[model samples]
Target: MQKKYQKISATSGIMTFDLELNSEISKVWDLIATTKGFAQWFPELSIGEPGVDGLILFDFGNGEYEEMTITVYEPQSILEYTWDKNMVRFELVGQDNKIKLRFTEEINEKTTHTPRDISGWHMCLEKIQGILEGKEVSFTEDEFLALFDEYQALMN
Candidate 1:
């Protein structure tokens, strides 16, 4: 499925993507909410705790870690957390047997890293979809760069 991206507010710097997956809500929930499921697609994800106010550590396997705090947690429905100067939110909705996932990133300001982050999220979503479909999929650096260029042009 083609992903949809929208600018919630240019002034507020909010951006969002709506993704539809051919999977059940429960499966989708696991992929986003559980540490083991998260590791399937996001190999660097490690959570100190399992709920709200917990520490989410992202280790790039380079001995460097980016820590973020989970601000909201509702199993199988909502997951939100602090990401640097912004907040990332994931909302899941079930329709029949399929699932709809809405991802929102609240940006404080547009920076050089904005497009990079957007592209990364885009790839992540794709990876999640692949996992749900039982397909081995990943994006190369070149694919990311292409996606980054697309987001950069869209932002401009």
Candidate 2:
């Protein structure tokens, strides 16, 4: 899997980067739809949606959890939804044998950036990239814990 952009939003006006992967839409879709698929990368997700109108709820196990309501689950174009107060959109396009994905999370100014959310998304997308391109991601459970700890530190 090729990583075009991987970093935090250190710029004004744009706090997120656009990451595209090389894979089919079906493979990409499965990563977002199935609980087992995401569980491979997201260790805090105790409950998740595998269908439309489904809600994904996860606790970082710090007596805090975030819940997102599913809004869209179209096969090839979009998967848009509200996770907590943040609005996330995933758009897909087919380029030959590759699936170009755009994952965007638009947050209100009132909403401060939580590192846990940031790191979790980062790891998950990386795993997705690996899966899409037929590469192995070395994201172990302990690795997830370390990432989560880093995020928690940033948040607090």
Candidate 3:
């Protein structure tokens, strides 16, 4: 299925994407909230704790790490965190053996890297969906550049 994304705001700097997956809430929760599952779709995540106020460290595999503090954590429902000057949130809604996964990224400022981040998140969501569907996924640099161009057009 083709993923759909919405630009929540251009001035306020927010983007949202919703995904429909044929999976249970618990399984979908683990894919976003656990270190192992994150490694499969997102970045290599290391957490100091497992709940609200916990620290999540995202390792980009280039010896660089970004530290984010968990702002809200509700099991199988919501997970919010601080990322740099912005915030990232995940909300999972389940109905009859399927899940509606919502991802929102709140950007604080528009920088040159804004398009890159937006494109990256777009690809990451696709990866997450693929993993849930028992498929292998990888995002290539060319694909990212294409997405970056698309986001640039959207933003401008």
Candidate 4:
């Protein structure tokens, strides 16, 4: 599950990851595009409207939330939204007997937090797979640190 990193510019970049899941495309779509499905995995996000320019709220607890806009929506195939200053997109493709989930993040600018954020996205995708496999998975700080190191190396 290694991510592909591309330095698009001195201050911007792109990261892409692909995962093959032995589940229906709809199931994978639900997890990444629906509120209830995200609650089971990435609970911080909730989809408000299921279309372009829709609102996606990021709950920060205690009645605090940040709003993200849905920039692209193509039902079960593509979902793209604003993530802070960057953009995050998810694409699902069904092939043969498996569903391919493609995630891409367009980094607007390079920051000290880039590596940490990249590592977090890596773990999040892994969690999604674990859910589909019905396996109990935990994301620990140690695991994130190790992944952070790996992605941080790419910055150099």
How high a TM-score does candidate 1 get? 0.88
Q: Looking at candidate 2, what is the lDDT of residue 124?
A: 73
Candidate 4 ranges with C-alpha deviation above 4 Å: none
Q: List the lowest-lDDT window of 10 residues for candidate 4.
A: 1-10
lDDT, residue 60, candidate 4: 91
State the lDDT of candidate 1 residue by residue for 88-123, as single tens digits. 999998876788899988887768888898898888
Clashing pairs counted in every model: 0, 1, 0, 0
Q: How many pairs of residues in model 4 come into backbone collision?
A: 0
Provide the TM-score for each candidate, comma-separated.
Answer: 0.88, 0.64, 0.88, 0.95
Query: What tens digits encode model 3's per-residue C-alpha lDDT throughout 35-88?
Result: 877877765776657898898898878998887999999999999999778788
Candidate 2: RMSD over Cα atoms?
5.7
- What C-alpha root-mean-square deviation, in Å, does candidate 4 show against the real structure? 1.2
lDDT tens readout by residue for model 4, 33-115: 99999998789999988799998999998899999999999987999999989999999999655998999999998788988
lDDT comparing candidate 2 with the true structure: 0.63
Question: 1-156 in candidate 2: lDDT tens per residue?
Answer: 222222334321212435676666777766766566666666665336644777777776888877777788776677777766666677778766666777766643223444556666767788777766678877677887787676445434
- Least accurate 10 contiguous residues by lDDT in model 1: 3-12
User: In candidate 2, how many clashes are counted?
Assistant: 1
* C-alpha lDDT values of all predictions: 0.83, 0.63, 0.81, 0.89
